[model samples]
Every structure is written in structure tokens, then in C-alpha cells.
Target chain A: MTSALETADNPQDMKRIVIEPLTRVEGHGKVTLLQGSNRSIQQARLHITEFRGFEKFIQGRPYWELPVLVQRLCGICPVSHHLAAAKATDMIVGASELTPTAEKIRRLMHFGQTLQSHALHFFHLCSPDLLFGFDDDIRHRNIVGIIEDSPEIARQGVLLRKYGQEVIRITSGKRIHGTGAIPGGINKSLTQKEIRYLQGDIGQMIAWSQGALELLKKVFFEHYNYHLGFGSIESNMMSMIRADGAFELYHGGLRARDRNGESIFDHNDYRNYDQYIRESVKDWSYMKFPFISALGQENGWYRVGPLARVNNCDFFSTPLAEEARKEFIAIGDGKPVQSTLGYHWARLIELLHCAEAIAELLGDRDLVGKELRNMGNLQSSGTGVIEAPRGTLFHHYEIDELGIVTKASLIVSTTNNNQAMNESIRKVANQYLDGHRLTEALLNQVEVAIRAYDPCLSCATHAIGKMPMELNLCDDDGELIDRLEKRADGRISRTI
Target chain B: MSTDKTFRMDGKAIPFEAGETVMDAALRAGEYIPHLCHNPNFPPHGSCRVCVVDVNGKHMCSCTLEAAEHMEVDNSSDAIIDKRRTLLQMLFVEGNHTCPACEKSGDCQLQAVAYHTRMLSPHFTHFFPKRSIDPSHPDMMFYYNRCILCGLCVRVSRDVDKKSVFAISGRGIDSRLVFNSPSGKLGDSDFSATDEAAKVCPVGAILPKHVGYETPIGQRLYDNKPISVVGDTIAKNHSEKPVVIGGPHE
Candidate 1:
């Protein structure tokens, strides 16, 4: 990777800014800003530090272990890896359709995953910034502060996550690295007791999800301009949708839309994702920049995740989330939402959808059926795609006749959003810090832009950590002028 | 009347039948001892010394030592755990046991034991050894990279299956499990999917043909519980149980 500092030219006239080990995110990252004369931002880049060579190392292993093995990529979103790998293995096994019981169980587990992940990002990470001011005391802008100030709201968030985790344990047999979904089908069906256990908490979960949406909506309306314009950029959107153009998470064909909300491609087979999307390797970061092939790299960069899914889909399958989606779209005035902070609103809507979907799936009798697996003959290749909590994820694999994985490729959700994330960071840096004296609060503005996407650097770079961030400002001659650091314990300090 | 001879293990008095090894006695009494190569169905072959326990003042392989009356054993002591952790680190370095990529991860006895010993990191440097995979069998695969040279397959194939299909040929650092057939492939031998040797592997080295992940991960044998609750010997006994996927029983 190119050093973030190297992006600037004319060292005599330019100042170099660097943010090492970006904080409040899942894994390690750094940001670099090259400032021209008069404080004009020349270049900005986000760098991913860790590299997990899961694709290369899985070469000699059996195809069936992909679901279990690939999940080790990210502790925060292992289920996304697990399900995507299972879907790909389903193709390797030559199963065109999973048994009803197996499909429902997998869906339940996925919904549970999405619920817990969104809850964690919103409550534990981002809410502190939204609830308190972004420029508030760094130590007070955390989940602990939320618990101290709003204990009831904090309790609901915790319970909501606990409920999602419980659902995962029931379906997959463990909370984090459960091996429930396999090729063709699941290993065991959910028992009646498990169903009853989740059903008892469904009412409370749904209420809490709605309450979260209300809280975000109220905050957005109160700070309409800032919420709508801060870190905002116009880009394309990509997501998965059912045949009816309804919102789909676990399984569906993919769709891409332009900034005006016109369909670029609707209900396209995800197996052909290579023809539409291309990953560009960069020297400075472990993450690959993915763009739409038709539009080329510059114009092809698009956003994914909750905002993209909500904007691209026709309607949500679940009732409560569908209403929230309508209200969210109305705020866009019949156009695609370009607000970056709007991602938080879109996330809550999806969380509501997940809770309702879980309740709906639990009522189905097939979840407990005996036809859990369809043992089919192995094929040479297979691909699986799903809308993970962050966005669309793809897992592709090729196996030999003996079922050993010969080749593998994965496009995780964070990778899909990589280009857009970098763009957002640059946009924020230019808007907030251009020709202005750098401060700890100004640096946080850059971080707020990145955190809006809730990008899992662990998934993108295939590593793990809480990640402490440091920002350094250098004068035109490249001499250090000032420094700001955010530690993992949520403390911010500055040195000059 | 023959009374069972009892031995103290980790402060608990564990009773053993005549001629029972320390590992067998502990397993039968629902006490777990960390081991890799030893299985209840096969005779103890002290090839992998993962089950080394401190007996009185000296260290001995629990699978090879017979349980004697009133014999005090230190299985969970800090020194023994530290020694086992070092041994595990060596095994990890010696083999390409990439648990993240292996199919037999959650069910692998080596991984569960590592968890039990609180091996947070592979303390030693990784050798990153270059090993070849044998996928010649129609229904099974042999990933040599994950092999710890446990020799369970060699024992099970020879004594129970009577196929004489697997063998170990090398010694010291060059030690490795080898196929006995002329072609050096599992397909060339008379090994069936149902053979006793097929289910005897303690790692991902000898995985069955089509059944890669019959059990999902979290529900797998060791996902929810620690390995200390179920030893390697009992995990082998419950390997055939349909409901229990990877780790030992509750």
C-alpha cells in the first residue's frame, strides 16, 4: 500500500495530514489528507492495514468447510460469511432449491444476525454521537454514557441484541460460530421449545425496534440540514431484491440503481456479478475498490447497505418497515437519498424488518420439519449471494472432482462499499477542514463520515480489533505541526 | 470379589477397572484428559504425547500408563497446563493446522484441546510447512497440512477394519502418516466409507467423501461447551451419534 503521506506532491508548498489506526470501527485503518496551498484538500485516502488471505489458504480444504471456515474473517459479522459460503456450497452440491425447512431456518438465523449486528452498530457505537453532540466530551460519547443517561433506552437495546443472539443460538446451536446451515440444507430443525422461546420475546423486540426508529426519526427531523447534507454524496446504489422487487436479505437476485433512482439492472442473477462489478486493486490499502463495470471506475462507484437497499427496492416485505421506507423515501422527494448520515435511519428500518421477519418465520410450521437436507451430487463450481446487514455479499468457489476447493473469491459487503467510503471521507475532510486549523473535533468529523457506513474493516481486511486512531498535521515542509489521538477507551488527546 | 481400583485425578477420586489406562479410567468416569492420538476403541499408542500428565514427580503419557490404586495425578496443574500449551504450540507450528480454513475445525480434537488449555496465541513461530493434499479417494480427502501425525487411522485400519490401509513411515521431524497401497492413494486401497478407519481420525487429515459439514458450527460438539467437559476418548465414542455433530457429548 502507498503511504497515505505520499499522495501529496510539491512537498515545499503542500501539507500532509495522516490519521493512523482509525477508531470506533471494527478493525485497523488509517486516513491520509494532502492539503495544497490555502488549505485546499488535494487528495484523501483510507487505508486498510490487515490482510487475511482466506482465499489462497482455503485451496486444499474440502468445499463443505467453507461455511465454517470463512466465518472466521470477522467476529462482528461471521453469519454473513457463514451463510454466503453455505449458499455457494449449495451450488457445488447441485441443489437448485433448499428444502422449505432448511430455507426457513437459514432465514431465521440470518435475520437474527442482521438484528444483532445493526443493534450493536447503532446502540453501542453510533448512538452516542447522535444522542450527545458529535463535539461533546469524547469519553461521554459512548454506550456507557447512554446507559447512565438513558437507562431504559439502553436496556431495550441490550435486550434487543440479546434476543437476536438467542435466536441465533436456537437455530445455529451457538451465538457466534454456529454451524447450522450447510450445503443443500441445515443439520437439524428447530424444536418447538426454541420456537416458543423466541415467540415470547418477539413482541418486545418489535416494539424496541420501532422505538429505535422513532428516536432516529426525531433526531433527524430536529437536525434536518445537518442530517441530510453532512458527508453527503451522489452515487449509485446496489442491493438484492425478490422477484416482485421487494426487499430481500437472505436470498434474492441483485439490482442496481442510478443516483436518480432509475433501475440500472433489476432482478439480475447474482452469479453473473463479475460481468457487472469489477474489483480494482490499489497499492495503498488491503481492500479492493469495486465499481460497476458498465459505468467505469470513476462514475461506477456506488453505495450499498441499508441506505442502498431501502432506496433501490420497491417495497419492504414486512409491513412496519415498509411504512418507514415510505416515510424515508418521502424525505428524499421522489429521488434517491444522498444523505450519508441517513444511513442510520435506513439501518433502523432494516432492523425493524428483521425483527418482524423473525416473528413471521417463527410462526411457520416448516421450520421444524424433518426434511432439513438435500444430499445432492457435487458439481465443479458454485456461487452464493446474499444481502448481509451491511450490503450484498458474494461467495464463489471452484472444487476438483474430489471436492477440494481449487479456487475461491469473496466480495464481502464492506468491499462493495469501499470506494464510496473513501469518497465520503474525502468529501467530509474537504468540507470541514479545508484551509481551517485542524482540531480534534474537525478530525472526528472525518471519522463520523466513515462510521456512518458502519464499515467492518475486519471483514474488508480480514482482521480484528477496536482500533485506536491518530491524526497528524504536517506543515508545507513536512514538519509535524500538531497531533490528535483517539484511544480505544474513548479518550481523545491532542499534542502540539 | 473384584473391587475397582481408584486413583486421585485433579483432587477427584476416579475409579478404574483392572488393566484400564489412566485415560480410559478418567473418560469412563466422566473426567476429561486432553489427548490427541488416544481413542477408547483402539489400543493406546503413545505417538502424540498431548495427554502427558504428571504422575507423582514424573511426567507420563496418561494413555500408556495403567491406573494404580491411590496414585495421585496432577492433570490441571499450572505446570502441566503450561507444558501442554507449549506442546500444542509446537504441534501448531509443525503442521499447517489452519483452523480457519480446515473443514474439521469445530470438531477437531486439536482445536478443542487448544481451547481447553487457553492457548490464546500460537506462541511459537509458524513453520508454514509445504505439504501436499491427497484427494485421490472418490469419497474422502487427506489434507497432509493439517495432519499432526496422531496415528489413530493406522491403528484403527490395522486392528479393527483389517484393511492395513494406513501406516507411518518416517521418524523425528520427517515423521508423517503414509498410505500402505502401492499407488500411495486411498482409492487404490480397499478402504470403504463405512470402514472403522474412516471415522477414527482426530483431525481434518482424513475427512469423509461427501459429508463435509453435516453439523453446523455453533451446534457442533465443542461450540457451546469447553473441551474439559468432554475428553477426546469420549468424543470418539460419540462420533457416531447423529445428533451430536463435532465435539464431545454434554
Candidate 2:
């Protein structure tokens, strides 16, 4: 594949840029460009490598076990996998018609999972770059950096996240692959004591969340250049819209919208997902791309995640969340604010909103003592859709007469966002690079773009097997001018 | 049996506490309920809705209902037996409950309860959601397929163990057990081999995979001996720990 692009050194060669292992992201992948002699990216590739057959291993198991079974996907968002799996099971049992109490608790838990996972992404995983310096050594760039640099704020973030996990534990039987949520209904009943514990922490969590919001405002306003340096792109966005036409996570219809906030699709039309989205396999990467099905592969550009969600939804149910979305869009709604930089701002807003919602749900006495598992015995197919910390997640399953899972399908958030990230990076790399050397700053910019999605490779690949990643740069003549030698370890070798 | 109307407790005919759970009174009177979910530490969540007993009117969950006076509590009532059978049916339907393939099929509490109630067939439909076996923890195996979702593991971890390692997630029929950490597998979870969550699972779901197949059924739960009689000695001797009468800790 590398031997295809050998070419003469001309103006076109001068315009090309290459980024490898897009930095600061959850998994590994790279992007490359071929200039059209007019300094335009004539050929672009979003290359990914690493594969494991999670779907294959889950085939023989009983359908009811999917919640715990699918949890091995990603360590960062095991709750997302759990939720998706539960939804899949529900589909097998046809349990989508949940009672109001069941719905509320489900939403609360979903919001909690989203909140904690996003908090971990921002404060623990991605924030250090924006706060300290993007080029800081990999060793000094993690949650500990926040602790060492800003102890008070880091502690607040950690505690707030812990509170979310606590809620997950209290509601479900466990924090991660909870057994509380079942095919027919929940396993455990909620109690007044649990409600009290959740209520008591509302004030503390709210304060901490507000502190994060204030910090985001300071960074955005104070460090204009830093914000500008992050990548952006123009693409379509998708998310869940509640029955009342507000932003929702737990159980709702999916909505796809363009940059102008026009609803292109909505109203429980998931069976047509393949029509709107087309997944394609690339040799270089195991993760599949979901392009706009109507426009066809490369032309169809859609994104999923915090940035995409905010762009797609008209309003959030919670007041603070609505306010945050407005503020976020105000920055650059002009052309779908494609820069991955916006992911940070959007994520903080979600974290803030989730905390507030948690407090509200816990304070409601009705929610506290309502029957947890009213519909525990039944057999029907059901569907579950929620916005994971990364983006929108869909779980669909079909069961046999015995209520065993006959088929299972999942549209993970990260996979949906793959194409968008690829397109977004190409745009950013094209706009900024001027046939310059592969500077660390430019490389960091590309990395931040991928990090914005907070993709979880662990969740994407469940089977245990080695998948190799190779990087090759070619010139116009289809000759491999530079090729990274394959080494026993994933590290790129200089021998080639 | 029909003439008695109620069983004698310590030779005094106390009207079974109207809805006063037989298990509660028995425990209150320094007697044991011999049930796993009936944790004296906390109110029973009733995931393992065993401990069924007969009130004057009908059979009910002993943990949830209050005992009433003069209630002819027939713990051995045919109605009580039928209710227990249904409860086990619910348990079996919720997960991949393959008793024959289960490691805990022998010494399993779910199996013991099933035997006590004479559950010949799992009448309810099976929601055999695909399960993941967590052999990740070196010393134990977590067969999520056989989990009854009793919340005992969750309760033990949070209420008694203080680790808060286990939890349940999703809602309605989609619910299943989860771990605290990101990787939902037991390997990545905060649970240790000795964590209370691992220890409290009553079915083959959270079995010590190594020990299940080593024993047989008759010698497994009843062995023709009533649980009340065998349970007393086992409770004092720590039945899980191997011990001959002349052996250490035996």
C-alpha cells in the first residue's frame, strides 16, 4: 500500500501533512494527506489498525447476560456498554414501555454514568493539555497533573466523579456492570435512606460542578489563542431527543441535524439507521466509519459526541444545561464549529448538567420509594438509546420464544463519530499546515481532535488477539518514500 | 396436620404474627431463618424471594410481610410450596441458569432452595441474556449467566464489606450486575477474590468455579438430611472450609 504514492517534489508535495497516532486519544490511529499540486488535500485517509472480535465471542452466550458480557469493551465507559447491553436485552424482551418511575431512575443512572465518565475525560484524561501545556511529556499529562498543579480543583473533580459512581452503585447493585437493571425490570428496590444520601451530597456536587463551569469560562476567555489552536470541522450532529422534544439520554428517539440546527431526521426511525449511516471497514483500522448513507461514504459527514449532541438538540430539559448549550454554540455556530477544541467546552457543560439533574432526581421523594421492578416477568423485544459520554449509543436485540437472544446489534458512539473525526482532522490539518515539518505542536493539535471524542478502544474490541498497526508515507508516484518498520512492539522502528 | 392449623414454636401457640414474617419472629426469638437474602444486617430486598411461609389467608414472602397473631402459619403448606416454586422460576428465567452445567449446582443456595421447594421444572420463560464468565479473578469464577440478581452481593459489598465494589445497572428487564471500575470485567473491577460481593452470590452466578464440579447432588445440598439439622453444624464448622472431624478447624 505504501508503494503507491511515490512522486516528484513539487508545490503539491510541499502542501501535504501527515499525523501519526493522533495524540492524547483513547486508542491509536493516524491521518495522512496528498496535496493536489494546488496545496489542496487531494487524497486523505483516516487510517486505523487494531482489531478484536467482540461481536464474535458474544454469539454463543445466552442473551440475558449481555449487560455484564458486553462490559469488557472499554474500561473508561463500562457503564455505556452495560447500558447498551441492557437495551439489547430489553429489545429481546420488548420492554421499551417503561413506567414513569422506571424511566426516571433509568435516566438518572444514565446521566450519572455520562457525568462521571465525562468528568474523568475532562479532568483526568484531556484537561491537562489545555491547562498546563499540550506538548508536556506523556508522563506528566494525566489526572495527577491536575492534582499536582491544581489540587483544590482536581480534588473537587475527583469527588464529584466519585459521587456519580456512588449513585450508580446505590441504584444498580454495582457501579459498572450493574445487575439491578434487568430484562423485565430492576432487581433492587430504591429506599428512603439511599435517597437521603444522594440528597445530602447535592449541594457539594453542585458547587463543584459550578466551579468547573467557572473554570471553563476562565480558560475560554483568558486563553483565546489556546482555544483557537484546537482543531475544528464542519459536520452533521446526532443525539437523542426526548418525547417532549428536549435533549435526553435514557430512552428517547434519535435526531440528526445539520449546522443550522435543522432536524434532518427524528421520531423513532432507528430501523432506517442504515439509510442515514453506512459503516465501512478500512484495512488500516478495525474501527468502522459511519458516513451519511444518503450522500454515500466520503461525502456523508456526521459526528457523534458532546459537540455533535449540543449542535443537534434544540434544548436540554435541565435549565443549566440549556444555558450551557447556548453559551457553547455562541462561540462559533457559524459552520458547525468543527474544531475538536469545542469538545472540552461541550463536555464540561454535560458534566455540570448531569450533576444538577442527579440532585433533582434524588430530592424527589416519589422517585426515592417508587417500586423499582414492577415488570420483572415478561418476554418481549425492546430497544435502548442513550447518549454515552462519547456520543449516542443504540442497542437492539431479538429473542426467541424462550426469551433467549436470537440476534444482537450495537451502534457504539465512537464508531458513529469515527468518520467525523477523520473529516475534522483533515480540515484542521489542511487549514493550519503549510507544507511545514511535522512539528510537535501540529501533531498535538491533531491528537487533541481525536481526544475530544474520548473514544474507548477497550470497549470497541472485546476478543483477545493481536492486531498490528503500520504507518507508511508515500509520495505522488505511489512509491513508499518513508515506511515505519514493523516491530514486535507497536512502537515505530527507524530501520525502514 | 390439618387439625393443628399451625406449627408449635417452642411449645407455645403464638398466633403467627399477622403478616409478621415467620422468619423475622424466628430470628427475633434467637432462631435462624436459614436464608441467604434474609441478612439480619439490612432489610431484605427480596431478590431471592425464598423464605416463603403460610399466613392464615395465604402464602407470602416472610421477609416483607408482617407476622399476625392466630395466623395458622403453615411453613409446609402446599400453597407455600407452590409460591416457592414460582419464586425459583423467576430466578431461573432472569439469567442463564443452567444448573446441570453450573459449578455451584451441588452446593448452591439456589439449588438448595429449589430442592426444598421441589421445583421440578422452571415454569417461567428463560431470558437467557448472553453472559460473560469472569475467570479474571484468579481464585473465583463469576458466571453472570446463572446470577439471580438477588442484590445480596451488592448489599454485602456496600453494607457489610464497605468496598462498594459491585452494583446493578440498566432498568426494567434489561438489568444486570456491574462492577465499579471502567472495565466491567471482574479483573478490572475493585472486587478482590475475598470481596463480600464475590462471597455473597447465592447461585452458580458467582461460583468458586474450581469447587462446583468436585461434588455431586445428593451429597451436594440435602443428602437426605434436612437443612435445619445439617445447617447448624455447618454454620459452626464453616462448611466451605475443608475439615475432617480430626482435622484443623474441623
Candidate 3:
């Protein structure tokens, strides 16, 4: 798999391959492949084109509004931004602890978000590629296709997503852009009626989530070599862990581990993340590259989200998910799993964990407590961090004495995985494109690499829309030679 | 006799008093005609033009146009709604109206009006005009970014509060709310936390200090229901509630 291509004999000829508007992702992105003389792959990079400037525009606004304001960042994962901003604003008001009811409700809301986002990604976005094969007709490779081929599974995916959305609506007051969360605490608590409404569907949601996991495991075992080796690259892992070193999603301290399953850092406060993480800007892409501070830039890049979280944690607090984690680890021979495609497996496990956790929270009595808010004095600076479905999200703010935000910065999940994503694209380009004539199918393999990360370029850039990606290939002289564009309507056209 | 004196608004006969404007009549009848600058408590200042309605054959500000009997008013027509959306888009672009980050979001008339009109995305180019915030006042803040230049504060301060503390200066795109005080700050002006003008702002331009987010979001005035059902009267009533700090249950 690591062998260099022998197709290129002449050292002077050059060609370019371009895939414009990559399909089935969350926002706008393009992959460019530069082929050197004789079909030898020279370079490949993913470029995020959209920009919203949330960090810059958020300045001068009141710190109290950040939680609701930042929800406009990404329509798909607004809850993550809402909770992260709320947590940051909680720090701004100097509230170290919230009422028990507020804490539990927030956790429940976060878990709901994870379930919905993972379901949408696994079923709506990536499943078509897995179910129909990567090179299947692009027309029949979507949720609509799934509905035609397997109606029961497709319906289950939709219903499971609806369950998560219902949980959000009950807690946050709306499905798309709710405003229940506020600084220091949430505005309201769950009532008996709302609790009962959510409880009615939990059993069905859990069964469907478990079935989704089983289906993924079966697929992985069937295509074992492709599942283990496709777009696989070695990198460090990062996630938030509870103080007791259990799996945590909503609130916890930072942890980083090396590829050899060795701990680099254990459970450090999120407020002090600057000491361990630093973001470096690149001229090519609008997204910032974040890496570990201690390791230097070259080896500092680490992966996050489900794959990282599953690999970095010692055990999950939930029972079934913990058992699944043990089997997942066994697949890696008691070592960190480096396969990029393992992200699908890891995501299914998390879906199971979120389902179990939501059931557990629903049983807790503190979810409906009346002490819903903690009115605290406003402080000048605060930081909030949470595990967004995609990865760890950070929201930091500096307020004036009058409570207006003076400065703001956010590091979204996709931004943290920038280096690893680019590396995976390059690896795939070298492995598949070298010594072979470029085809639309071969270029799609490159996109399959990115789909594994489930990158939300919209959240990373704080922009909008259903992502349509384009891949472009150019010669050494910078002329576009081959172009593949995936239109938003799910049609693929190749121009050479 | 009442039916004889009624004027048609979107094909529904809305009865009106002798001297009331179309907006006043609509409000009293519990019908919503979207408006930004016209408040029933104050004389209509037709500057915002968000309440423009087609009367007979011509478009006019519903707040200033008297409700003539048998008049055909196109309040909910597609053409009228599209024009209102354009006007809303202009308001969004001309000033920095960040609804998501504003204190008056759910309760805000501009935001509610936009929602009522089904204005999905701000289609126009964003001007991103630079504006200043006046936090010098001890009891209130003047966030100039959210100002829509409706002059409600000016009218309320002059006619109701008897302070004449606010006025509009400049012209066209440069127009902005100015303080009557020499220092041009709310602190130097005669404005108080209790002034009627403080609660008259339709947007978040003027806000009381230290009392943000007192009401939880879901129970807030516009969270559960659309703005049209609440009508203008209820929105004004909810916006008039005094800002209370450190209250367990206001």
C-alpha cells in the first residue's frame, strides 16, 4: 500500500486534477491535486472557501448574548455553539457551579445534539457511500436513495433524528434556533408534560441506535481491509474526560494521547487550554490549524471527535457503549486504531452512548427543579469548552467592566482536524492517483477520506449552507486540466 | 352603520373610529399591520416606512394615512409583503442590526416584523457601518448599532416624559439619534431609568443597565407564538415592563 508509483518515466510532463464542489458534506470545500511529471502525486490540499467572521463581528456585543448569538454559526450544530457560549458566559459572570437542575438539563441537551448530529451524518451523509459503494451512480447515493433501497432503515434514521430534535425543542424551546440557555444557567426546566413526551420515544430510539451500530459493525467486518486501511493516517488524539477518567461529552477537562496509546496530558482545565493548544493560520485556507503546544507544529496536530474520544478514553460510563469500546479496542490489538474509516465505527458507538445517556438523564429527578438559574456578578473574562458532536469546541470572551465583549475567539472542531484532513487527502492522492489514469471514481476516494472526519466547514468558518465540494487538478504551469463538480442538486458532471 | 364605515384590509372589513389612522384601527381591531416607527401612544412618525400599505391605487404609510370608508387596503398582498421585505432588508443593511446578539430580540418589533413578513435571509449586501455604544450612563446604555432611527425615543422623551432629551441629527444614511445634553451622552442628558422614552425603543438601541435577560427566553413575549397573534398592543405592553436587577421573580 505504501509503494511509490512506477507509471511516470518522464520527469517533464505535468497534469492537474480538480474536484470542484465536494458533495455530501456540511459546507463549501474543494480538493486540489497537483500531479508532478509522470503521474507522481506532488501535493493535495482541502480549501474551505466560505467566511462569516463570527469572531470579529461578535465584538462590541454584550457578553450575555453570546450564547444565543453564536447559534447562528451552524444550523446543523447550533446547540453545541449555544452551550459552549453559555458555558463561556457562565465563566464571564464568575459562576463556577450551576444549580443541579441547570447542569443536568444542559447535559441532556448536549447529548441530544450529539445523537441528532451523528444520526444525520451517519445516515444522511456517509451511509450512501457505504451502502451503495463509493463508485455507485452519484444520483442514487443519498438519503433518498436509501429510502428507495431500504425503507425501514431509512425511516429509523429519520425517526431517531426526530427524537433528538424533540429533546432539543423541549429543552431549548425550538428545534432550529432555540434560546433556552443563558449566561450562568438555563432560562427554564423540563416540565412533567415535556418529560413524558420525551420518555415515550426513548425506548424506540435506543433500539434503533443499537441496530445502527450492529449494521456498521457488520459492514466493517465484510470489507475489513478497506475499512482498516482507507485514508488511514497516524496522529495524536484529543478529547475531554471526566475527573475520574471516564468518557465525557458535555463537560470535562482536556486530555491528549499519542498514537501508541500513551497519555500526553490528562484532564487539564479547559480555561487553561492556551497553555497546551495553539492555532496557526495558513494563507491557503480560511480555517485555522490547531495543534498541541508542547509537541511543536510538525508533530503537534491531533485528531478529535468520535474517533479520538473513543480511542482516548479508558472506559465509558454507560454499559453497552463500554462493551462496544472494549471490542473496538480489541480490533486494534490493544493499541490506538489509526484507520480513518474507523471514525464510522466510533461514531456508531457514540450514538449508542448518547442514546443510553439520554435515557439515564430522563430517569433523573433533578431535570425539573425550580432553581433554574444562578444569578451571579459579571466578571471581565471567561472561557467555555465542550465536546461538540464533531469535536471539542472552545468559546473565549473578554468583556469590559460594562459587560460588552471586547474580544472573542472560537476554535471549532473542523479547525482542530485541519492538518490531519489534509494529510489524509495527500495520502490517498499518492496511494490511488499515482501511476494510474485519473478518473471520477479515483477522485471520489479522496472525498471519502474527508467524509470520515465529518468536517463542518460551515461551523469552522461560521458560514451557511449545504456543502457542495469541487475537486480541481492543475498542471505545474497552473492551468486547470481536469475538473469534477458536484452540484447541490446531487448531480455530478465531469469536465476534462 | 359600523359595517358601512369599515375599510377593507386584505379583504377583511376593519372598523375604525372617525380620526384614527389605518395602523391604529388595525391595532384596536386586533389585526396586525407591520410597523416600526408608529406607536399608538405617540403621533405617527412615518420615517421607517415599514408600515407602507397600498391604499386604493397608491402606496402610503399606514400610520399616517387616515382610514377612509370603503377604501381597499392591500396589507397582506404579495407585492406589499415583497416591498416590506425589501425595506426590512434595507434596515438590516443600513445599520448593524444583529438580532441574535440584541437584548430586544424576541421582544423586538423589527425582528418580529421580519418574522411576520417571512424575511428569511438578508439578501442585500451588508454595509457593516461602524457605530459607537454609549455606556457612560450609570443606569442605561445606548447601543447605536441597533438603532433603526424610528424616533420613538425622541417623540416619547419630548411629548410624554417632557424631557426632550433625544433628537435625530444628520440626513439620509448618516442620520443617527443624538442626545440633547452638551456632552452627547445619556449620562449627561436628563434621561432616567424610569423615563417613558427608555421603554419606547422598538429595537435594542436603548437598554437599561444591569438587568439583561431577566425573563427566560421561552416564556418571553415572542418565543412560543408568532408576533402577529400577539399584535402590537401586547408587544408594546411587554416591552414596557420595567427592567429589574437582582430580582428572584420580577
Which candidate achieves the best lDDT against the true structure?
A: 1
Question: Per-residue lDDT of A120-203 in model 1, one digit per residue for the tens?
Answer: 878877787788867777667667789899999889888998998988888877798878888888988988998998999899
Candidate 3 wrong stretches, greater than 4 Å? A1-14, A23-27, A455-494, B1-36, B42-101, B111-132, B209-218, B222-229, B233-250
For model 3, the chain A TM-score is 0.93
lDDT of 3 by residue, A1-496 (tens): 1113213343235565656555323446776666776667866777766577889988877777788888899888899999999999888777888999999999999889889989887887778778887777766766678889999999998888898998898888788778778888888899888888898989898889999999988888999988799888889999999988888998889999988888889989999998999998777787788989898777888999899999988899999999999999888887799899899899999999999999999988999898877766778888999999989999999988777888998998988888888888888888788867665568668877888886464222111122354566666677776666655565567756
lDDT (tens digit, per residue) of candidate 3 on B1-250: 2534799898888998888789988887888889888776567778889999999989999998888897999998899999999999999988888776576777887888898899998899999998888987877999988999888788778776789999999998889889989888888999999887887788888888754565656776677787778755324554565323221111
Per-residue lDDT over A253-321 for candidate 2, one digit per residue giving the tens place of the 0 to 100 score: 778776566666776556456556667767646778776666666556577888777766678877887
lDDT of 2 by residue, B1-250 (tens): 0122233443445334434456656665554344656544345565566776656566567777665555555566576678778877787777767654344544566666676678888887777776666566545567677776778777767765677777889887778888787767776776776655555566667755223122322345545665544442223223354322211111
**Better structure of 1 and 2 per TM-score:** 1
Q: By TM-score, highest first, what's the ranking?
A: 1, 3, 2
Question: TM-score for all predictions?
Answer: 0.87, 0.62, 0.86
DockQ (CA atoms), all models: 0.52, 0.03, 0.37
Ranking by DockQ: 1, 3, 2
Prediction 2 global C-alpha lDDT: 0.62
Off by over 4 Å in 1: A1-12, A23-27, A282-285, A455-467, B1-44, B49-93, B96-128, B216-250
Q: Compared with the real two-chain complex, what DockQ does model 2 have?
A: 0.03
The stretch of ten residues in a row with the least summed lDDT in candidate 3 chain A is: A458-467
- The Cα local distance difference test for each model comes to 0.82, 0.62, 0.81
